[model samples]
Target: MNVPGDGGKYAWRTEIRTRRLAVPREEREREAEALAEGVAALNAHKWVCAYMPVGAEPGSIAMLDALRAVGARVLLPITAAAGPLLWAEYTDRDSLQRARFGLLEPTGATLPAAAIGWAELVLVPAMAVDRRGVRLGRGAGYYDRTLTAAREDARLVAVVRDEELVERLPEEPHDQRMGWAMTPFGGLRRLGGTEAEESSSAG
Candidate 1:
């Protein structure tokens, strides 16, 4: 599977190693808090898609819990067609499953990808991303396909570590860029790729 790499697979490996080496619990917590606030703010009004945190990934537990506290119906991703994703309503963590690609997923019945049309917000996962909103995911491009079906007004935020929000990235026309990068401490910034742009040819 081809993916966006700094230059080569080795470079990406190096970057991942560095990120893992330097990320202490303190830094991770700070980034998670900042991300939670930004994510919660954008998701305050509607249904939101949340993902289970993977290795070294920032947790949406805080933000998701907050949304739940406010009586919002939270949703989780269920695999769909290649390079795309689907979702299902989930009220808690109990419905999750350990799945393909080592991703933790929710096993509930699937809702239409079009269901996102009613969503006010969606939080995505990323291995790395850019200030321009270009995300370097695990190469499946699942969110890319899902974003294609999301509501035009839906706020798409990608949860990542602060350092992953860098200068730029490689993007394909089908790739999805988020509007915000909810980091652990750096808060939020208007990112580059948008639902419109992704829908356009600019992705």
Candidate 2:
């Protein structure tokens, strides 16, 4: 559902990015740990497509480990030219190396973009996600293009901080809505009114 006039995409991006940057280092770490625990609690999925959160992003190395602890095959994204994102298997923390945009990618074999369809769960990076499931990325269309290949039954989850989940955001025709969101305080929230409970749980 598109909500008119929630601010332009760029402006909303700037505002949310500023808030994320303002988070203290210690707070971020604590939140990352909480997020890891939350993800670990959901052990149903076998293959999960996720990202290595960099800089002030909401996750940590521990989050990936938590997913792996559940015996899931984790797939990380490998940045490519202006097109759909490539994929690589994440063996461990040691397999990661710095890539473009200061992102960390796996050193394993790079898979084609269509490989995303193999995932049962996809944890997407976002600056913020609204109650209606609109995700605000870093103004890049990587996920927007890459997510098209995800299996229709695959759970599309946006990972964001507790406060970053808001009421609404600017949306575009190409912007995909996430089915769920993982947060520090809220474990797994079904967005777009699938579950209307107030996300006030503790982290």
lDDT winner = 2
TM-score of each: 0.78, 0.92
For candidate 1, the TM-score is 0.78
Q: Which digits, one per residue and each the tens of the lDDT, describe model 1 over residues 1-203? A: 22345554356545754665678988777766766665555535657777767767777467667677776788877775464567787776676678866676767788877777777877788877776777777666577777888877777777777667667666678787787666666665566655344321112
Quote the lDDT for 50 in model 2.
Answer: 94
lDDT of each model, Cα atoms only? 0.69, 0.86
Q: Quick one: how many clashes does candidate 2 have?
A: 0
- State how far residue 98 of model 1 sits from its true place (Å): 2.6
In terms of TM-score, the best-performing candidate is 2
User: RMSDs, each prediction?
Assistant: 6.0, 3.4
**Worst 10 contiguous positions by lDDT, candidate 1:** 194-203
Candidate 2, residues 10-43, lDDT tens digits: the string is 7777777777788898998899999999888875
